[model samples]
Target: MVNIDGHTILTGVLAHPIRHSKSPLMHNNSFAKLHLNYVYLAFDALKNQFSDAVRAIRALDMRGINVSMPYKQAIMPYMDHLDETAKLAHAVNTVVNDHGVLTGYTTDGIGFVNSLLNRGIGIKGKNVIIVGAGGAATPISMQTAEEQPKQLLIFNRKNGHSFRNAERNAKLINKSHPGLAKVFDLNDRAKLKAALHDCDIFCDATSVGFGKLKDQSVVTDPSWFHPDMVVYDTVYAPLETCLMDVAKKAHVKHVYNGLGMLLEQGAASFKLWTGKRMPVDYIRKLLLKSK
Candidate 1:
């Protein structure tokens, strides 16, 4: 157990390859602001040691952990119970340790929803288009569908496999919320453009704006975005991604980065771990200052 200022505080790490995760900065900063004696770090775990690292989390008396990238799904089996949302998404991003039993949860979905709702962009009765079909997309799509959106559409770049995986995930989401999810092939620009034309919100769930792919953007056409549409990108590093830039230039009503979701989800995980509700405004201000 780690002790800080006589407090036996616990810790967690966002594990992934090339993980310069801002989680440590965001979470540790919050802990400091709240005068809590705790720390959060980042770990670049080797593939073979993933299980070992998770086991160590318990042995070390860690309060909880946040999983990222390749290990989100890989760490599922080690969890004692999965929250309903995590089980549906089949991915666990946050884990809580309750007396050695680690219960898994996915705050990404609800995080994005809370972010949008907090921004006054109502998900209810709005049509949403989510770009990308990877792990990140799963929770976003699943949680968004629960909001009873008028329609939830998913688009992936790769033709066959990507679209298929998205469809399978959509089907799983639809199982809980019937007739609310749809998958589309983005390879066909015409269909993609048509779908965008009818969307009220566009979410970039891909890794198009991070690290080496910072120069890349998923949406190539500006004409597809309208002035009334809201564009939200799940990339926060640059604060403004290429997709967000185009959306702004096009006079989109509300354009936001994933920073809000990041904060809200961290808040959720914090609540799970400590059974205390975090101050949303405090966390938001901290993130803005860091930006």
Candidate 2:
């Protein structure tokens, strides 16, 4: 039986729409299996309430916090420290609270890489085209660039925030990911189409085809995707995103949503909190079963 004691450690994910998160199941199951005195919860906090949320983490002495969309970047300024990954990505997805001193870290990039490797999809020497340069895309691009891909192309709409982020990321990647990273304007169909043609991997980091943009597709034409390509959409809420549905119609050999990445990042956060290895495969099955 599950029990909560006075000494039990508490953790949760902070997001605007907490109802859609499966992180509680992922973390709580691991805690239960390992017999750890930890309880995971989800807190639905709006953008304006974020500062108070962090303050609660400190005031309540919560063990950790998992951050999500709209707050990843917002939480950075409120954090006491940012790990190297979080600093480089300029975003934080996981936070470890040690005696009220919270340190932020980005597990999204490493999580994405681990998921790809776990699936037997190699990254080295492959050309990758990433769609959008928002929060989800930042760690993904950072991690992918580190894998030494032959080329890393980030496509974002012109005259927008994503374009500015992509431009900054290009300069960031050139530091250690050096010279292989490039940013393209999503408005330039000719450039985007060309990049897609040669890409071995196409990642959708935008929230198109989910939420309010459910009807929109990040890449309208499936013709740009080749049979040799692996299509991944970071939007996992709808389960089958528009891009994944189109990939299915095109008979693409490998297509995936953000589920694996989600699990991987969650696992990383769990380890950071508990200092124990997560049952990755077991958690994968739990999520798949839920789906």
Candidate 3:
């Protein structure tokens, strides 16, 4: 059981439909392992009530909270400061309240980078392709671009705002590293096939491979994968996603689920709240066993 007292510091994640979050369990277990006087919880809050939720962080003197979905971009206006990555992505996922001042940071990028690092992989000097431009894909794309990859390719449905987001991201990256980033339509199978054949790292940040769309995959053909590429799917549920399975069937050298990204991002937030590194390996094993 979690030890609660007046001195226990409060931390949590704020999002609508939050009952499915694994954050509370992950952080609470980590806290218990370290014997830290911190308690983590999940709060289900709609958009209108978000301002009040931010105020509660100050009123309760809580350490911080993780913002999700609709709140990631919506929660930014209330922050006193935003870390560079948060500003770059134009979204916030982690907020740290120092005294009464709340600062926002986007750790999803760090999580993605560190997850690759954990497996002895780095994006530098490698051709990289990211298949999405939403919340998960945007930061990953921005961060991967920052890592000086040989080239970065972003794919998204051409008809939606996500396609605009892809164009915006490619433009932003091109500003710093001219001609290093490009955008393409996800429906252009010929281009996607060429990118997969040439790219060294392929990441699926889309929602197609999990939840109600668990059976679907952005890359419908398993033959598109090659042995030299590293494949990563940012969906932890049903751990082995269709994309990962497809990569495996093609004999891709590295296949990973999003569990590491989840752990690493939470670890980054944990460090922001408390100035210590999270025991990532232990937490990884714990989560896997529970799964």
Candidate 4:
């Protein structure tokens, strides 16, 4: 029986268009199964009211919260502390509130790393190329940078908002990461082409291949992709994004959708809130069944 008492721990997700989120389904089920006295909810807030909504976390005494879309970067200013991942990404997807002291963390990268490891692809000492540097891209970049790759090259559309964001974050991650993250304008096809020459792994951290732009591929030109290269797309909506489609057509040895990354990231937040190791396999089954 669902019960609410004075001791019930409140947790939730914050976003403007939150109804589309399946996070509540994922988190609440996990909570019920784990018997955690946590009730997760979602709050929809407009962009103008974002500041007030962030304040509501502490104002309402919420234990912790997950942030999504438009508010991830905007929410950072309100946070008291930011973990390295958040600092590098300039975004926060998870927030932990301990007696009103909110600490921000970015789990998107952790999820990507965990997903990559499970697929037997190692980022360590490997040259990497990431397309796009927006919301989905940044945290994954920050998280992947920690693995000590040989080098990290990110490309974004020239002078676009994400390219600007990526340019700023490129310096942030390189300060401590051994991989030496580099940012370049995606329009510079020659530069990106050269970077991908020795790339061991290339991940599409952009939404170009899916959503409204499902027909587009970031690397539209036939770029060089070796058989050993691991191709991944952060867009999970169509399962096989245009980038993944091209990779598959080229017979790339390993390819992955963003579903695993999404699950792993969600699992990371679950750990932060409950202090329990996630039932990954079980969660995987649930996600598959949902589809």
TM-score of each: 0.92, 0.97, 0.93, 0.88
Candidate 3 clashes between residue pairs 3 or more apart in a chain or in different chains? none
Which 10 consecutive positions of candidate 2 have the poorest summed lDDT? Answer: 213-222
- Model 4 per-residue lDDT at 217: 83
* Candidate 2 stretches greater than 4 Å from native: none
Provide the clash count, candidate 2.
Answer: 0
Tell me the alpha-carbon RMSD of every candidate.
2.4, 1.2, 1.8, 2.5
In model 1, which runs have C-alpha deviations exceeding 4 angstroms?
1-6, 17-19, 159-162
Scored by lDDT, model 2 comes in at: 0.89
| Collision count of model 1 | 0
Model 2 lDDT at residue 10? 93
Ranking 1 against 3 by TM-score, winner: 3
Model 4 per-residue lDDT tens digits across residues 1-291:
237788889999998667756677778778877778888899999988888888888998998999977678888889899997788788899999999999999998888999988877789999888887776788888777878888889888886877788877688786776439888888887887787778889998876766568898876644466667888988776777888877877778898888889788989999998899767787777777774
Q: How well is each residue in 85-176 modelled by candidate 1, as lDDT tens digits? A: 88888889998887899998988888889998888878889989998766677898888887888989888866555577688888987887
Model 3 lDDT tens row, 1-291: 468998999999998757767788789988988889999999999878888988999999999999876578788899999998888887789999998999999988889999999899999999999988877788899999989999999989898667988999899889999999999998889999988989899999887787778998888788999999999998887788999888989989999988889899999999999888888888888888875
Off by over 4 Å in 4: 1-7, 177-179, 221-224
Per-prediction backbone clash count: 0, 0, 0, 0
lDDT of each: 0.81, 0.89, 0.89, 0.82
Tens-digit lDDT track for model 2 on 1-291?
A: 249999999999998877888899899998988899999999999878888998999899999999998788989988888999999998999999999899999999988898899889989999998988877899999999989899999999988877888989999999876688888888899898788888899998887877888778877787877788899988888898888988877778889999999999999999999999888888888899995
